[model samples]
Target: MSHPKIANTDHDVIDVIRARWSPRAFDLSRPVSHDVQKQLFEAARWAPSSANEQPWQFIVADRFTSADGFAAMLAALNEGNQSWAQYAPVLVLAAARIEMEKSGRPNQHAWYDTGQAVSMLTIQATSMGLGLRQMAGFDRDKAQIGCRLEPPFEPVVIMALGYPGAPDALPNEKHRAGETQPRARRPIADFVRYV
Candidate 1:
């Protein structure tokens, strides 16, 4: 089962959109299959991007497949995230290719395109009854070193992916509280301006 953190929206949204919310607690016992992971990546593969650059890269490590790789990825997270993210079965580092492949010029939309890809991935995961938490709290230098990422590709977000776990499984009360809290967002009118 996925996290019960559904959005309380004034207007109706599709089930997947309403159901999508990041969760910190992940089921350590449940391992995502390679086939399912492939589907997620496939969804990301189709995201639209400027000039179709599709400038996103990902580094994935699963606890069940490679313990050393998982440990290395875990080390790249900040201490606060490591305390909880360690329980996730799958950890992914998303990156962006900062330069246009052909012209060797900087691609200004690289990060935005990467975010679009991740959003597609997130929706796919939610539809498949999985939950993921995208985190920006990581040591970029450490992640680059651990993944051996070179120029043109830089880390964007580190994500913890797996089945949702019980809130009590969280490492501390603070995180547990955050997990159980109602999801909130600004009203549509506040963020949207219509001419």
Candidate 2:
């Protein structure tokens, strides 16, 4: 089954940005290699951060290797997310340090920097021909327990990653149509304000 393409670029854009789209329909049969998984995190590692803190961290739970552990990972996500995420070969909980090391002060831009890190990871996944779906619907407390995350680190987003699967193959009726939906974004005029 062919993966869906939904990007609608208004102007010229890089191929990665043009082709990147989140997919819940993941091919369970195809496994992402450990090397490729490391490469993805390595991309996130290089992201710029406040005071060069580089606080982002990811805890990957692979269904391909550890089904029980993967179940725990899926349990961390909310009910709606669990319905589809269980099919993904990999799931990652993205987190960031809430404080800075040098002065032991709170880093106001930590979350923003962490987001940049995830953006890098996302684009890198695209370049590698993998699909990634970053989700906000997860239980932070459960993830903390499942991933054994300690303080000084926080869970921000859970991403379902793998090869794109046939949307028609999804067991849920609601998501069979998700992969084919048109991609839309607000015009720059709506969000960008020139001071």
Candidate 3:
């Protein structure tokens, strides 16, 4: 069954932008191929960054090729996330380098740039008929340790990536409810102000 939650927009938007929505229900049986994975990251690689620093770094692991690594990545997530995210065949830890590579100064825009990269990744995934969910509900400490992140680099978010699955495939009612519910966003006027 296909569940497409196309956005209700006020103006014209790109198909991929309209089509992108994070899904908690991920197909457990289907694994994203390495070639496809490269394409996703390649999108992120082209994302603009402050001073061309390209602070984003992704630690990727998939159940098929890196089972133990995938388990470790899953363990880094909080229990609630683990409950639902386990079904995703691929797990990713997005990180950012806090310090400027050459200057050794703090880069305030590191997180923002990393987010832009993830945005590109999300659009790419959506175009590929895949689902990407960014979860803030992960343990920072565990992610740092599990992913072997160092001082300059810090965990930003954990992402569950895979093909969208049935809402009933979720482990619990709450997640299923989240999956089947209509998507919502504040009216454009609520967040945007024209000068």
TM-score of each: 0.96, 0.95, 0.96
Off by over 4 Å in 2: 1-4
C-alpha RMSD of each candidate structure in angstroms? 1.7, 1.9, 1.5
lDDT per residue for candidate 3 within 6-107, as digits (tens), equals 777788999888889989898888899999999999999999999999999999979889888999889988889999998998999999999999899999
Of the two candidates 2 and 3, the one with more favorable TM-score, higher being better, is 3
* TM-score ranking, high to low: 1, 3, 2
Better of 2 and 3 by lDDT: 3
Predictions ranked by lDDT, top down?
1, 3, 2
Where is model 3 poorest over a 10-residue stretch in terms of lDDT? Answer: 1-10
Task: Locate the minimum summed-lDDT window of 10 residues in model 1.
Answer: 1-10
lDDT of each: 0.93, 0.89, 0.91
At residue 77, candidate 3 shows an lDDT of 87
- Candidate 1: which stretches are off by over 4 Å? 1-4
Candidate 2 structure quality by residue, lDDT tens digits, 1-195? 433464676788898988899988988889999999999989998988888998888888998888887988899999888888888999998888898978889888878989999999999999998999999998889999998999889899999999988888777887888788777889988988988
Regions of model 3 farther than 4 Å from truth: 1-4
Clashes of 2: 0
